[model samples]
Target chain A: MTSETPAALAKAAERPRPALSMSTGRAGDRIFAGLSRGSGLVILAIMAAIAVFLVWKAIPALQDDKANFLTSQEWNPDGAPAKFGIAQLVFGTLMTSVLALVMAVPVAVGIALFITYYAPRRLAGVMAYLVDLLAAVPSIVYGLWGLNFLVTKMTGVSGFLNSYFGWIPLFGGSETGGRTILTAAIVLAIMILPIISAITREVFVQVPHAHVEAALALGATRWEMIRMSVLPFGRSGMVSAAMLGLGRALGETIAVAMVLSTTAGIDWHILKDGGNTFAANIANTFAMSGPTGRSALIASGLVLFVITLLVNVGARAVVARRKEFS
Target chain B: MAKRIEVSGLHAYYGGTHAIEDISMTIEPRSVTAFIGPSGCGKSTFLRTLNRMHEVIPGARVEGKVMLDDEDLYDSSVDPVAVRRVVGMVFQRPNPFPTMSIYDNVAAGLKLNGVRGKRRLDEIVEESLRGANLWNEVKDRLGKPGAGLSGGQQQRLCIARAIAVQPQVLLMDEPCSALDPISTLAIEDLIGKLKSQYTIVIVTHNMQQAARVSDRTAFFNIAGTGKPGKLIEIDDTSKIFTNPEQKGTEDYITGRFG
Candidate 1:
């Protein structure tokens, strides 16, 4: 009777099931799958909530009389009429990120390769463990260190660059010293180095030992093996590593706030003087704002949120491809 | 034809484990030397020592002299890199570089040793593929990824990559253990051809492969070995297989012990 009723039972079971719980699988398995899928929905809901809250809070400033929401740069969101434009703030965000990437990418890739290959085997392992430890170090500590030691040391570096390559506008090499985009970028490089290096090292180490051996058997030297086999094998990993590092550098608030002197302007000379960043502006002025000012600042946060989200998506895509090689 | 690889008082240790002990044998330079022993009897360890690959692992050390025409390989001042460049190796599994094209795989050794001219690299790649007898099947697909090749082709490509360096000695560690019989035959034929220009030392667990390819066979044994592995006998391959000098060797080759 059981065998004869198999098809009938299957047909009966094909009826639309309830989403809550009507399955043969354990509560744990079903719960895990549900949680994994539902986590995305949860994140989307939170993001939507934040956006709605921001728009509601920003309503007065968005409808203000002196200027539209995004056109003016005066940033007096609560002085009688209350006016501000994000051109300068947007410019600062783009400049700081661009400067950070230029400074960080090469050093990160180099450190990753060196940590993976050149450091003595025992030393390399220890160094890698330490870099991973560095990733866990609080952002505030890095800010404190950058403010105290990095700024002072960077002043001397600015003077030296002024003596050497002052003609290049990016390094106008001005004695205004190094608290500028250039110095902030250097500090950001140090912070991001550990991240990119750790990922690249992990990826390089995973390069099939067989390929490294094949290269060695082919008379390739250690360096040559890394260049031809390990580096190429980990190319996608390196790109994702760079993008992850850029994401961190873009969103870093405390360190950039502490290190950069808050001046407002768009100067192409990265070494000219300290400049404001979106994160720095938020951290610096949150205490002095009224309701309208608070809403304007929150809108700035929205910009940073969108920027970081894009960086994260790009990094995830690169990482997705990196996994394909395995 | 530079047909001798002399080993004297060879002892190897994996950080005091005493893996290979007091092993001494002279292998035919242009003929295959098969070291047949039980699983733990140091056959692979002994093979690696021939090319200084034994030292790749941390704390793995060898205390003995292996010579190719009187140059001491383990001498304190001798560079293992130079020794390896002269004595190439093929591991048990095929390990073609996944990132490179088939042409690049064959040309890797030449380019790394400062052979940079495009013309020369191109020529050597073709020569090596032909030498390993893989050129016919892969000649049309030299630009394709090397990892795309079939298992047999990949192993052959590895062989091509090894011999590309033009080493005087070839050390293979169970080269066919990871391949099908058809690929094994292809490698065997390539090995026969390689013997003209290279001295060959191979370690194998397959008794039939030993009988089929090698000219000299060295039988390793552990005698009540809470001790180290020691060489039991070394002789012409036919003699060792047909009538080994040691009873242990006889038992082992006749499908008795391992």
Candidate 2:
């Protein structure tokens, strides 16, 4: 169209421009989307395959069982007709992990707060690095240290608790053996402290500066400011971090097996020896097990997996209900 | 209960860098005073020093005499937390406690100060919400999350939260800068009402806002980049707007310079 011709200009504007020849960007996007979908499907496939294999192997052993798998506090999977139950192991797993969480979470949160708010500026970085280093220490090393070193030191402490706090059923055992569920829980607590603390630190750090200022401006003490601003903002994140720590506590094998004096009976006494966990049982028994015993261990592993999954889902749901704040 | 502020030889620093230098002024009780300055001139920093909020930052500190009546706020035995309780502050952006209900957000300060009776908390929360002009909109939804409110409403909620503690002096650091014009007007009106009961100090980049809301105005200036900010002039808002005593104040008010 000529430059001065208004009608011709309008017509030209209405016409679509020619398309570019290259379509690589669109092709790249499609390929990337497909790759991500494929990866997700691969994870699903692996999980399903594991579930199916566990069920396939476990059914025959379960069918031959002479006792109730959910109630009987005995493990004789290699016995004639395979007589075993996960009741005791399940109790041990839950009790130890819950105790560990009860012990570690508060301390972890405190350490996180100290690092984020209370520590000298130069020291905070060094302290955070040390906690990270603690997390990276091998579980096997922890197992060795927990069994060799802590078990001995804990005897005196266990004796003290039994003397002063033994009125509670959990700590009401006559015996004061340090090789007990409490010891295992204590070790697990130390092992998981860094994981929970580090995540909580990040969450605390992410609390908006404005909210903290709001609390401080309203005459909040440092601890009170943390309570009003940092704690609420990081609650969901802390729950998720605790859940992750719980997952590790549940699935932990070498350290729990090494520290816990395994017993097949369900006992409420936390101070005395006698407890078993799904992962610890599997780890301790797998080496000497026959085919059916192996399948039984696999079944126990399946239950542990489901329990961890349920814990994660439950934590996620709790976090989701508080999503409005986020 | 309102209290007048008398600041003298105030110097604030962030690490080694001086932020606000040798600022001194008297803020009358039951009136609004506005501090107007360009970006990075530390008007906000000086405002924070009145209540000891500046030291919350790592390596940030203030050296000065901030006299609230006869009490020296920076005295060795004076707790910063108590100073803050007496001199409340509102921030540039609305920062309602995200996890709390509107009711809980308003009651947060009282709870911190050990007010536990449910009846007392309810009374103070209602009164403070009314004081911030937020009661009518949020009264029916007291259980709703404070963060669920609109930006303007959230800012008012923050104000309600501050006033719930019954501070004598209220500091607002560009409280309406993030709001739309209509919301800004609403807050300006609220400030005018609030001035009758509290000694109010506000920092604003908008010179017209200072003229519109403040009874007295202080102009802050920096010589160059990285230089500490200085208070150039303080006078009646009307006189400062029409005919300033200092050339820098006149230049800034006339938009010839910052």
Q: For each candidate, what TM-score against the reference?
A: 0.89, 0.93
Superposed by TM-score, candidate 2 places the C-alpha of residue B250 at a distance from the truth, in angstroms, of: 2.1
Q: After superposition, how far is residue A83 of candidate 2 from its true place, in Å?
A: 1.0
lDDT tens digits, residues B19-76, model 2? 9999999999999999997888889999999999899888898898999999999999
Q: For residues B1-258, could you state the per-residue lDDT of candidate 1 as single tens digits?
A: 434788999999998799989988888777888889887788888988887878866689999788888788888898777777888899999888887899987777777677888888888888999999999999899999998999889989988988887888888989999999999999998888888888888889898898888888888878655578889998999999898888899999887873
List candidate 1 segments past 4 Å from native.
Answer: A1-41, A51-74, A79-83, A105-122, A173-175, B1-3, B223-227
> Taking the candidates in order, what DockQ does each have?
0.46, 0.81
Per model, the share of native interface contacts recovered reads 0.62, 0.95
lDDT of 2 at B133: 96
TM-score for candidate 1, residues paired by index: 0.89
In TM-score terms, which candidate is top? Answer: 2
Task: State each candidate's clash count.
Answer: 3, 0
Instruction: List the pairs of residues colliding in candidate 2.
Output: none
* Candidate 2 lDDT by residue in tens digits, A1-326: 46679988889999987678856588889999999999999999999998899888888888888999889898999998689999998999999999999999999999999999999988999999999999999999999998999889888888998999999878787888878899999889988999999999999999999889989999999889989989988988899889989988988889999998897798898988769999999999999999889888888888888999999898788678767556
